[model samples]
Structure formats: structure tokens, C-alpha cells
Target chain A: MEWQNELTRLVKTSYPIVQAPMLGVTTPAMVAAISNAGGLGSLPVGGLSPDQTRSLILQTKALTTKPFAVNLFAHQNSPVNTAQADQMLQFLKKLCAQHQINYPKPDLNSIIFHSYEEQIDILLEENIPVVSFTFGILNKEVIHAFKEKGTVLIGTATYLAEATLLEQNGIDCITAQGMEAGGHRGTFLDSKTLPLIGSFSLIPLVAENCQVPVLAAGGIYNGKTIKAAFTLGAKGVQLGSAFISSNESLAIESYKKSIHDAAETDSVLTKTFSGRWARGIQNKFMMEVENSGLAIPDYPIQNALTTPLRVLAQKQNNKDFTTLWAGQSASKAESKPAGEIFQKLIKETESLP
Target chain B: MEWQNELTRLVKTSYPIVQAPMLGVTTPAMVAAISNAGGLGSLPVGGLSPDQTRSLILQTKALTTKPFAVNLFAHQNSPVNTAQADQMLQFLKKLCAQHQINYPKPDLNSIIFHSYEEQIDILLEENIPVVSFTFGILNKEVIHAFKEKGTVLIGTATYLAEATLLEQNGIDCITAQGMEAGGHRGTFLDSKTLPLIGSFSLIPLVAENCQVPVLAAGGIYNGKTIKAAFTLGAKGVQLGSAFISSNESLAIESYKKSIHDAAETDSVLTKTFSGRWARGIQNKFMMEVENSGLAIPDYPIQNALTTPLRVLAQKQNNKDFTTLWAGQSASKAESKPAGEIFQKLIKETESLP
Candidate 1:
């Protein structure tokens, strides 16, 4: 069975599997390891500054000469609303005080925020081979610029409409992110409600509608799931939770342990963490914040406000405070090197009838 | 390409496809058509009296000699609270008045409420070959009786735990119902939140854990989805929304039209219809009732309160006041005879690699 399809040919990988570029979880070594092991590894630079993004890409390049993708947060930053920010700050302060942790004052003004536009020049300068983005689409000019550089562009979509829009905007590939996906949903289409289409539905719907090759993401952790995605018309599969426990992942030990010990029902979608819906294991913070019934500010604002607490929690090894983002099949994650996991995925998929 | 798996053999069907027993939608003709077309057809008697159940079974048996399953609502009726019921009644009266429809006075005492236990005698007397249930598990005595009669007992499960429990209770097969499934969720385990696991995650997890043959339900519509379910480790596939528009379905013309016009994003999960979560197309009644924020009575009570409105709406061809139960891929539904739909499903599955 030849696995060399349009998606694999476009991405220049031996297999159609792509490691999901999960923010805070994906490391440079992990990206390089997956890329070197015959699958596409993605470096997540969603909230990173241009310098940080450049350094990570350089580190990955040093480890492997294989093609990889650089992912960006294409979401437009919402204007800071002082009243809402103050309310959230007070709420977080109360939560921190109750937990006996010092609440660090967030210097919102001093926070260095780099837009995807600002990082594009750096990506071009570094001669990155592939680029992927979520939360929104890039402008026509930026897409034109990437196309000129001969870089393969992939966009994330939570719905068929979003996938169609990505294709119209000249995206080379579409990653159909299902509701079972762990990180922030890439729902950019304006609708009265959130689209929670699962992979079983979303993959075939998007693949049948869009001419571009579609990669299925969310709840995919093993060879069987990979084959399921392909059977549903996906050109490839993107996996995040499966690699959260890999040796090269940047997730803390407690987070990795939670993924290992979790069940299928353990992960849930909650907006309290980043004000954008993300799937993670339910914890005290998510429960209390949701139960409080307070209006959560939009992302970047909520993300910035909670950064100090998450950083402190990470340092203290407190799983409750930090976001333990994982897909529905977190329990299938294995504690192995990224290359070994990649190799196993290839073997498992090949062994399937 | 032979589809003679354990599930197919157990159900006595040529194809491992089961037409979902959608309450208020499935008809005797539809059941018989599917059964005669080499797939398992199910007669839904979830809320019907023994006389009604017997008539439907006899009607189906008259149309086809092939074996079919009879489905029951095994849910225990909650203690009726008059205060809550009265509140719901007042709310429904107001809604009816607003719609300029006569609100029929519900005879609470005269309501023909029959338990699954009572219906068991009729099933046994009729020598029903297959029995499937949802909402809760039947008692040990009921299982023993069914097993003694050589009945193939199938159970519905939304979570892996429920599937495991069903397997432990001597269930012959388990239907892994994903969150994308329409109608009431069969969540029996007590939990703080609902389990919304998708088919991609739920089917594989349930299939791997349970010893019984697993059937994947939810968001499955065509041959490609059937293959996807099989690849995900399910031995068979159960689909409801796909058959809603068939010629033999009991769904009203307006309801079928709404399903035909729906997009993937058009359907949503709402609890306002029956005080239990069910997916359907978003309509005026669901939105208005949900916006009212009035406390909804438990099932059977709430189901009773909304019955008049739903029935009236059906008569007037008004889609706004009725439950338009459908899965996420409702748009994929085709208008055809049930036999044609069944044959098409088999043809599609066999055509896939």
C-alpha cells in the first residue's frame, strides 16, 4: 500500500501523519524528531515573539534537515477592555489567594505581543518550508508572499465552511480539526453557535466539499484511528495528545501523568482557561471559574491574565492551575521518544488490513 | 468483502447495517422495508402502550418475514413533581397561546404510561427475536428471560463505562452512541457533566474494552462513514438521520423538508424539548423555551407537556413547535424508499476499499 499521496507529496514526508503543533506542549526537539522519523513535525509559535520563533526554528533545523511546518496564531488580538480585565484580575486574585499562591501583577502594557504578520518576515528569512495557522486565516498578500517562497501552506478549520474559505484563500491543505481536538478551536466563521462536528462527521463532510487535501485531527492517537481517518476521506492525520507524553514534549511531568492516567471521558471543552474553547482534563480551576458564572474575556486578554498563575503552577508542579490540554483519547498516549512514537505509528498503520 | 461478521450473524442480516429506531420517525413500513432489504430494521416502542407495540410489530411482521429488533425505553420514570409539572404546563400554555394554537388540557391521570417491565410480557408473548434498549439497563431477571428465549439483546452506550457495564450484564451487542447522535442520550452513569465523546473516540475505546460486538452510531450516513466505523473497530453501523427522509419514515413532510435543507452546522443539542439532551435542528420552539429559562420537568413529564404542541405542529405542518431530531450529518439524508436506501448503503460499503 503506497502512502505517497498529494498530502505527503506536498509536505515531503514519508508518511501522511503530522504531529500537531500544540502550544506549550510541542518542543523544538520533538518537532525535529518527528520530521527526522519520516513524518511532518510542526513547531508551534502561536504566542511566541519573532526572536523566540526564529530560535526554535533554527534549533529544529539544526537537529534535522527534513521538511517541517511552522504554525502561527493568526487570530486578531481583541482590544483590551479595562473593566472586564479588572474583573477577571480580581477573580484570579481571589483564586490565587485561596490557593496560597502569590498573585503576580500582570504588566499588560509591557507584554511583548508579536503578530503573525510580524513573524512572516522572519519565517521567510529562515527559509521555512511549510507554514500552518489556526484561529483565523491570513490576508491575501501574506498568502501570496508564502506562495512566492514555494512554502506549502496549511490552515486549520473546525467546519466545512471554514475549510472552503481556506481553500479560496489559496491554502494548499486543510487540517479539519474536530471538536475532540485539545487546543483552541480554529472556528473563524461567524455563526450563532459553535460548530462541534466530530471527526467522524467533519472529515467526510470537509473532504467531500473541498478540493484541497484534508488532514483529519482530534481524538486520533493510534494506527487504527489513523486508518479510520483515511477511510473517512482524510488525506492524512494530525495528532497532538498522542505526543503529549513523548520524551521530547515540553509538558510537565504532572501533565504527562494526567494524560497517562486519564480515561476517554476525562477531557472536556472549557473556555475558562483561555476564553477560547479548549479541551483539557477538568480541574479545580476550570470548575470554579465555570461555576462562578462570570463573563470570561476573549482570548489573548484572558490568556495574558492567566499566564503568571500558569507559570507559577508549572514551576510548583501543580496540575490544577495549569492547562492540561489533551484530546479525548489522552489515555492512548505513550511515554516514548517522538521518533519511536512516529515509527510505531507508521508500523501500526502499515500492519492494518 | 463479505460482511458476515458476528454482529451480522447474530442479527440475522446480510449487511451489518441497522436502521436506528428513531421515536416519532420510524414506521412499520420503514422497518419492514429495511428488514426485507437485507439489513436489520428496528421497531421503536419506547413510549408506546403494549397494544400499540403489538400492532406495530404485527404490521412489520406482515410486511417482511426476516427477523427484526424491537426497541424499548428502559429508563425508569422519575417521581412526578406536581409543582414542577404545573410550572411546565403553564409555560407550554403561554407558548401555545403565543402561537395562536389551542392548548389541549393534558389528562395527567389518564396518561397511558407503561414501563419496560410491563412491555416485556408482550415481547415474550410475541416471541420477539431481538430486543434492544436505551436510557438504562434492564434488570438481571429480564436478561435471564431474554437469554432463555434466545433473543439477541443489544444495549445503547454513550460512554465506554456504560458499554463495559452492558457487556458485563450479558448484552449480546453494544451500540456505541457518539455525542453526534440524535435523540436522547443513553447516559446511565451518574456524573457531574454529560459525556460528549465522538464516534472516532468512543467506538474504538468501547470496542477495545468490551467483549461484545460493538456497533457505531452517530454521524454515520453513507458507505464511506460505514467503512470509517468498521475501521474504528465497530463491527456494524447504526444510522438514524440518514433514514429520516425515506419514503416510509413517519416524520411529517415539513420535518423532512427541514432536515433536507439543513447544513452540518444547523443541528444542535438542546435539553428544552424533553428535559434531556437531544440533537435536532435549531427552531423557534427550542430557542424560545431555552430562552425562557424556566425549570424544565424531568422526562415523561416534560415529554407529556410538549406532546400536544408537537402533535398540533405536525398536523399544521409547522416545523417550529416540533422536535426535528437529526444527527450532525443530517444534510446527507436522501429521499428514497427505505429498501432502496438499505440497498444503497450495502452497495456503498461493498464498493469502498
Candidate 2:
């Protein structure tokens, strides 16, 4: 049925929402819970290998025969110097010593790039109904590949210009991320030039300019904000931080409790965690990163350099070394079952006039 | 002849603008310039006695008989405690020694506040049409006295609750002072609960509930922000900090330059100069205020205490010590004739659709 607002109608869903494919946070079970509840679920395959990405897609389908999207970090790995990577690894080794754990050698597996071409082949064969890319534009070849298979192409942008670029490339929908959203700022088109586009300002701007529908992302957790986004002309709202503590997600219980306790003041943009600006709860790890006068290596290498620290920190409850990625709407993250959260969010959205 | 549907029309100006009645900065000449330019010009008579207030008003009337408002501090009198005032005087006496001049005694003039009630009485007898009060709210008794005389009473509120309270008390209009505004915060309700209401969020919230016309009074200087404020539901826009450099203002050249050179990141809210929080271009005075562990007294007492330091700092060309008050829109403050500034603002406001 061609409805007035087909995003709400075209996607058969209990709610006009997408469970954001938050890499390292979005699990197979998390995708299942949101999809099974009749909303589109997204599995983040951004930081994973081809085998891992294939397993997640297959496992998500295993749990729910319902439609789901596979997300990829389409951003290029920035050039990392061999000498700089060693210094970053050395700093990590000292942190590993704090936990009395043996330092592991940096291997090719850590810096390995999973081709979007290969990931596309898997999704195409697996018949994934949706595919989303973040951090950069999906090239014409890859976008065309997905379109040939009837897959919905959702390209993410952190600014209006990127969204314009996405629409220019025949992308289906655009996601305008405000500064408050946590994790890697999927913005590379001169973050300095973009007006600190708060959701209140950015959504109206993008919606007014773009021909394709814009899905508002960043800081939308409560039903009030969700309704406000829709009122600003968003067809659908994609949520990331709100799903951090869901029962189906893989975060530690303390992480969930931390999000619950955080207020609007708790989040700040710092390059301390992963060398890229992301919003998260101000933690001891963030403090240490600030204090350690080190020129942070590039993203994926920096991502690998801090892996041991994050893993050990999460396991030992030493929050100082943990890579705690959270969005501006961290306070709205729930530890309840995803189904209840979805129902409640939809109910709240409907409640707002 | 009363205009409805917009806060601007209620203001009854050819151009929907108000000349910021800056306390020390604005002179009769500047007020007349804005008035002559088809905008409402204003001067702070709070610093003057009833006789002096009448003289200034008449002086401005000689320049232009058009509508102009007399702004008054709404408190009872200067809150300067004798002991604290003595201590501040002693500190200034030492600086006076360095300057080879005798330290002036607490000017009885500075201590003498023409109470809003007393000021309104003067204005009423003089047949003044508009009166605006800041620093606090004028009493309902006084508000009624002016309203009976067909005078418009404008109250300054730093938060939503204060705005609601102002309207409840029959205030004819309100100045929505956001966190970006310079000068003493209008702590009509409570000092500690002073809200840093940014203009983007504040104007609409106040306008949505306010029956009286809403005037957005914060970091607004240029046409873009003026248009934004109107679009956000303001009737008239007020510019205090932006007027610091006008030909009729009292600021030193360096003081005006400080504002002109400021970036959006340059402003900081500090309780350094006066005890109450005020945003300004951060300087050495701000550094001292940040470092000083002294518990500043309330309102005019703290204002009186710092008067010596500010005055001395300006005379000695020591930019560090002066209480250089400005808002987040300091970058837009320009050195020009008052008429040109008013004309520019009005032209910009009219340019908006």
C-alpha cells in the first residue's frame, strides 16, 4: 500500500523505528528482539571480519525470520605508521600489566579490512532486506549491487552536506546525526565547518533540503524526543544508545545501570577512548586517556590498540580502561526486555500530540 | 492600533527592536540615536537619583521626543555591607597608592538606588510611557501604579518560572535573558536556581506560555539571529552586549575591542566580578575570579565591592581587572554610531521572511 508516509507503512513494523546497528553493542539477539517485535532490526558488522559478519547475519535470521539490515563501517582506514602503532601498543601493554595479564602481540588480524564487496555478496546471498553504511558514502557499484537485490540503501551522515551527497548517490534514506550521538562520529566532511547541528536545528534543515526521506538519529530515546523528531519531518527515528542496556544486548549489567544513572550532563565529546570523537558517560577510562599525553593513532589501529584494555576493563569492572560508547540519550537506555521497551516507546510516541 | 499575533506589534515600534539600556555603557545620546532610528531606545536610570533621572530624560527628550524607556534596577538599594565595602575600599586604596591618587570614598551616588517604586513615581509624574526593570522584579504595587497611568512595564526573567511569575503579576512584557547574556543575572526568584536558559530553547518555551509579548534578550546582534528569534516567536529583540561599542556607550576602547574579538567559545559564565553570575569575554579578571576562593556577597554589595577594582583597571589600561561584561554574541559587537547599529539591526530583522 502506498501510504501518505510510507516509511511507517512500507516497513511492516510494530513501531516506526530502527534498532540502530551499534557496532560492538548490537548483537544477533538484539536484532532478533527488535525485529520479532515488528520493527526493523539492524546488525552492526562494522568492526567485524567477513566470517563474523556472515555468522551474525545467519544467526539473526536463525532467531527471527523477519526482515533485518546489516550495517557496515564504509569509512576508509586512515593511514597508520608502523612506529606510531608500536608506541600505542606499548601504552596498551602497560595497562594489561595492571591486570597481571600477558600482553598479546599485535597481529594482521587486528588491522585486517573486511571488503564491503565481500560483505555485500554475503548479504545478497543471504537475502538481507536492508543494508546500512556509516562514516562515508557507499560507492555506486556497492549501492547498485544492493539495489539490484531490492535491498533498501540507508546511508548515514553526521551533517547535512553528507546527507546531500548520499541522496546524490541514489541512497534511499539519510540519517542526520547530531553532535550528541555517541560512538565514532560518522562525520568526515569537515567536522569543523558543520554548524554544531543540534537535533532541533539539523532535522528541520535536512528534511527541508533532501528529496529522499531523512531518518533522524542522535539523542532520541524518550517518546517525547521521538515524537518531536517526527514533528520535525523525520519519517523514522533510528536509535543507538537507547538499546545499550536492553535485555537482548550484550553489555555488562553495570553498564546498563550506569546509563540509567547518567543525566544529560554526563556525556561529553572526547577523543580519549578511540582517537575519534564520540559521546559517552564521563568515566575513569576517559580521565586516564585525557591525562596520558599521547598522539592517538588512527581509528582501526587505535581501535585495536585499546581492545585489550577494553576487554580487561569490562571483565574486571575497571571502568578506567573500558571503551564505553554511549549516545546522548544514554539515560533513556533500558535494561528491560527489548519488546517492552519498543512497546513503551511506541506508546509514548503515540501519546505526544 | 494594538498589534496581535506577534510579540513585536505589541511593542509599537516602527522597527521591532529595543536599544539595550546598558547601565554604565548607554548614554542619553545613544538612547536618542536608536529612538531617532525608528526603534525603541532606552537608558538605565538606576544609577541616578530622581533629579538626575529627570535631567537625563529631558536631555534625551531634547535630542528626540520619540518613545524611550527608563531602565531601573528593581532591588531596594545597593546590597553593599559596610564591613565588606570597607575591605573592598582598603584593597582599592592600595591600588590607588600605585596610581599616585587618593582612593575615593564609597560614592554616596553609587550607593543611592532609585528604587523601582521611586523611579516609577518619577516617571509617572514626568509622564513617561515605558519603564523596564532588570536585576529583579518591581513590586506588583509599583507595576499596578504604572499600568494605571497607561505605562508599559517590562520585567526581566532568566527562566521560565520567572517569566510565568512575571505574567502572573501582570507584567506587560518580558525580556527572556538566556545564559549568553552579559551583566548581572536577573535573580528575581532565587540566586542559586538561576537558569542558564539558552535563547534557542528559551524564547519558544516562554512565548508558548506567555500571554504578554515576549522579547528575546540575549546574545543577539546580527540579522540572522534576529530573524531566528522572531521565527522562534519573539515580538521584539533586545541587544545589550552588542551596544557596548556604540558611539554613545561608556566602555573603553579595549573593553569594546575585547567583545569584537571574542568567538562563540570565548564567553564564560563567572561569578568573578560581581557575586552573581555574568557571561563575559574571559580575561584576567575572569582568571582571578575563577581562582579566588572568596565567598562573594549578594547583588549590589558584591557589585559595590568590585567597583574600585573595575574602575581602577580601566583607568590603568589593565584589561585584566575590569568587569568587562558581554554575552556570547560578543563577536558581533561592532564599533559604530548608535544610529547605524540600530539601522543595521532593523534592516536585518525586516529582511527575514
Candidate 3:
């Protein structure tokens, strides 16, 4: 608890562990479970409609009166290129052909992703205590609005520069998301270039330089790692893939199994799945798409494009085609109740000699 | 001091910090200075003749009475591929044409870098207390010989799998080199694939899983980072670029200046200079070579091929041509005596509440 004073006071949590907001994986039950266990659980509100976001947040609230965070994506939406979109669809057609599935053409109507402003409005309306963001920095007005509501604003940073920017922008906390994290990289600068610094190195640099409290994320799965983070000057630690296999997680059985069966070196970073770098257990879909070297559309577009394949693959329990988002240390994950996992983390950290 | 007991007892150092053996950077003075300051200094004897290696070790011993380590590359020497070598030479020719320098043909007889067997014999004769290796694991017979001689064996691993392999092979210590580290990656597994995992993630995984004691390396610059490594369960820390700017280091004034001028995101991982993945400051040579997409020869060959240009560039103080090896956190390095830097690290760590 020596490392918990500042962060614990800010988040009002017994433990400084923050369950990462993993899209399509973290459920309301998982969020509530982690919060109820005295750790902060974050509901992934990114890419969800305003109404959907509100309902999910409310559901999480109903499950636990304890404080929790709502996560959102603040990425700038790039205009869809028709030509690139067509090429991407054609590439997917070839991928579908290999799997003997039909490739769906781009739905022009579905091009627009969820509006961040609308999500903010919903968060404000519900008076959410904490709000974490990824992809990019929120505008000043948005940040001001959140600050007005006394929201504990957390931002994700892949490099020290991003952490400095977050501190300058009045962010309450910064999550130093190392390159080994699951799902999309939270890098906001020079997005094409891979910074790819590991947590061991990144956390200390971010913690020492950035004035704001640091939340170490990526490849953190157990109590030892949590203790390591606190030692590295992180006020808190955010875990993603480690919680994916928990009973409270909404991940498909196959997804959970994929995480469980993974080896330490199984995770690979690829842009094929979401047109943004993300670490995951390599599968046939990732391999083929990477091998083909086809340029895919940007995020939300690429994310939507691969939805069918992922869904169908999940239904058929075909891990080869599904995106198995996981951190490099997914091998350490245990299939247990999230509350039990939280307790185990606490016990392990406390037991460190 | 709390984290130093196990490592200090094993290595006979007052502190758990180990100065990394950086070829072309670490000098006898630097090694002795670190050892004199109670941190174990390592001599980079990799790819050196037995006579040259012995001279350097003797020089270091003459300067300092403290125990030190000698490092060697244990990579398997593959036969030169004439056709591939020719293609690589041609590609370099094009690069040289741009610089208006006369391209030198391969001295085929100079292909064999050094003999590790002979190097080991010299270490045994010198009664070196510590010997660390990189690139690949040594055979059991070699490891057994070192162990019999009371030489504490440390091996580098980029992944947990490599650490397991090192432990199974009876290594006494494991230096978990994260991807953010400068210099050539120590990965011996699938050499072609870049396992660019950060230190935050890599160290904890290696420390928790590996039975042998772990030494965390890469992107560690100061006392805070040293403390962070211990938190990650490292018995010690091996720092390379952190000492690059130290007065005792052999790095040129320009090279030291480059390290001092770099930002957190300035360093990049490239296989251009050595055809082996190493993190360094982005230079004209690296940028052009990467852009060319030309297949380069393996390490030692490509490293030798660029030596002349680098030498001339260094003499001219042109960072554009020289290989400015550095870590992602190179910006933290300060120009000072190695002993002062070491003391600063201890002071910073001690001051931490």
C-alpha cells in the first residue's frame, strides 16, 4: 500500500490495480466484479453508440456501487478512401475465399464510427467518476467539460512524449501503455512509426519525467509485475489480456482458450486486423493478411471490415481466423473469477519479500 | 541496498548495477571506473583476438581491483553465401555512390570475426570472475568449463523462452535485454524475426519464470530505473547507452553529443548497420539503408562493410554517417564521469521515498 497513496486517493480504490478496458472482451460484469473487489474496473465505451454506452455504464453501476471508469477512443476519423476501401474489400474477398466464406462489401452507411462528443455527453449526463481515453488526446473543451464534473481523466501514452503532452493537457493520470499491450497501441504521435518500448523501460522514464501519476499497462498479469510497476514509480497498474480469460469477461470460449493456451512468445504485433498496430496471438488471418502485404483501411473501417470473419470464426470456434488479442505475457493468464484474480494479485503483491 | 544482497554476494559488488559491455563504446577506463564505484563493469571482448582480449582485461585489472565481467558473442558462424554477399555488396555500392566514397570489396579472408573457444581459454587463464554472453547460448561443455573455473555465467535473452533455455543450460545469471535497448539484440532464436518487446513487460516475465537470477538491461539510465529493475525482480541491471556519454567511455565527442541531444523517441531499431536488429539514433545511413529495401548480409559482414564510412564520419563529426547506437531513453544520459553517474544513480534511488 506504500505506492497507493496518491493514486488510491485519486481513484478511491483500495488497490491501485485498474482492469484495462478491453473492447469486445471486458463485460459489465467484469467491470463491476473488479470494482467490487476494490480494484478499479473500466467499461469499454469506445466505438459504442451513445445509448449503448449509457446502458452499459448503468448496467455496470447496477452491478457495483463501487467506483469504476468508463473508457473511450478519441482518435480522429480519417476520411474513407473509396479506392483503398475497394482494394481492402478485394483483399478480404481473397481471405474469405481461403476460408470458403462470402466477403461482404463495404456498407457506406456504416462508415461513420461512434461520435466521441456524444459519448462525452453521455458520460457527463451519468456523472461518471472516472474516464480513460486512448488513440488521441481529447480537445480542451471536452477536457474542461470532464474536469467540471470532477472526473478523474486518464489518458494512454505509448511514449514519454505522449505522457508529457498528457500532463500538459491537464490529464489527471497517464497510462504508460507499452508496445506489448493487447488490442490497439495507444500511440498518438507519428502513428506509423513503431516506438515498441517495453514496460520495464517505458514505465520508469514516463514516471520520472511526467508530473502526473503513472498507471503502468501492458504485459502486467500478476502480483510480481504489479509490485514491479509500483517500484518503477507507477501509481497504479492497468491489466488487459490477463483478465480476458476470467469468468467475468465476456470473451468467447475460444478467445479465452486461445489466451490460456498461448506461449510466452506467441503474441505478435500486426496492423492487418485494425489498420493500427495491436499485439495478439498470431493466427491464420493475421498471418495471411500480413503475408499479402495489402494496405487496409484505417481504424473503425478496418475494425468493421474484419467483424464478420471474427464473428463467424468465433461461432465456429476457429481460432485461426479470429483475432486473439493478447499481450506478450498471455501465458501467465489464469481462468478464474475476476474477483478471485484481483484478490490473488493483492496477496501476491503483499507477499513480495 | 535492499535489492543488492543476492546479486552483490554473487558478483562481489557493493551495488547491483552492471555496466553493459558495449562494443565500440566501453573502454578500459570506463570499465575500471564503474568497478571502482562498486558496480560491476563488463569488458566487451566479443569478436576480439585472444591476445587483444587478454590485453584489455589486464588493463582493466591494472586499473581496478574489484571483480569485473568479460562479455563474448556466442553466435554460430555460418558459412558466407557468395551470391547473397555479392547482392549485399552491390547494394552498399549504390549507397557509397551517393556518399561519393570508393566502395571496398569484401576481404574474404577477414570473414571469420573471432574464435569464442580461444576467447574462453584466455578468460580461464586470466581467472576472470564473471563472463556474460549474447547472440546465442553456449554449449553445455563450454558452460560447464566456465562453471568449473568459478566464472559466474550470464546470458542474454530477449524473451522468456530464451531465459528458460539459458537456465536449462545452467546459466548462473540471465540479463533480460528488452527491445528498447540499444546495440544488437541478443536474441538467438528465429534471428530474422524482431521480438521488439519493451523492458517493462520482458523483465517481470523473465524474473518470475526463470529459476536463475535475472539482470534487467535496456533503456535503464539512472537510479530510478535501477530501482525499477529491482522492483521487476531483477537481481542486477546492465546499462549500455546510459554510460555512452560518460567521460570514461570510449565513444567519440560527436557520438556522446548525439546521445546527449537525443529525445525519448529519437532512437530506432534498425538492421541496416549490422544486419542485426539494434536500437540507435536515426541517422542518414540507417534511414537510407532502410528505405532502399535491399537485402543486407548477416552481422559482422554488414558491420565490417560500414566500418570505413563510420570511421570517416566519426572523424568528421558527422552523425549522419556514423552508427549512433542508443536506447529509446537516450535523452536521460548526462555527460559526467562514469563513477559520478553511478553515484548519482545511487543517490536518486536512495532519495526515493
The RMSD of every model to the true structure, in order and in angstroms, is 1.1, 9.5, 2.3
Ranked by TM-score, the better of candidates 2 and 3 is: 3
Supply every candidate's count of residue pairs whose N, Cα or C atoms clash at under 3 angstroms: 0, 3, 5
Candidate 1, superposed: residue stretches over 4 Å from native: none
Model 2 ranges with Cα > 4 A deviation = A1-4, A9-14, A98-105, A108-110, A191-195, B1-353
Model 3 / residue A63 / CA error / Å: 1.3
- Residue-level lDDT of model 1, residues A185-247, one tens digit each, is 889889769989988899999999999999999989888999889989999999999899999
Weakest 10 consecutive residues, lDDT, candidate 1 chain B?
B105-114
Top DockQ hit: 1
Ranked candidates (TM-score, high to low): 1, 3, 2
lDDT of 1: 0.90
Ranking by DockQ: 1, 3, 2
Here the TM-score of candidate 3's chain B is 0.95
**Fnat for model 3?**
0.60
Best by TM-score: 1
lDDT of 3 by residue, B1-353 (tens): 57557778889999889999998889999999999999999999988998899999999999999999999999977667667777767777788788876666657567667857779888999999999999998888889898888889989999877888999888889999988788888989873256666787788878879877889888688776777678777888888888998988777887888888877677887888887888888888887877877787788777777777777777677778878889877777788999999999889878876
The stretch of ten residues in a row with the least summed lDDT in candidate 3 chain A is A103-112
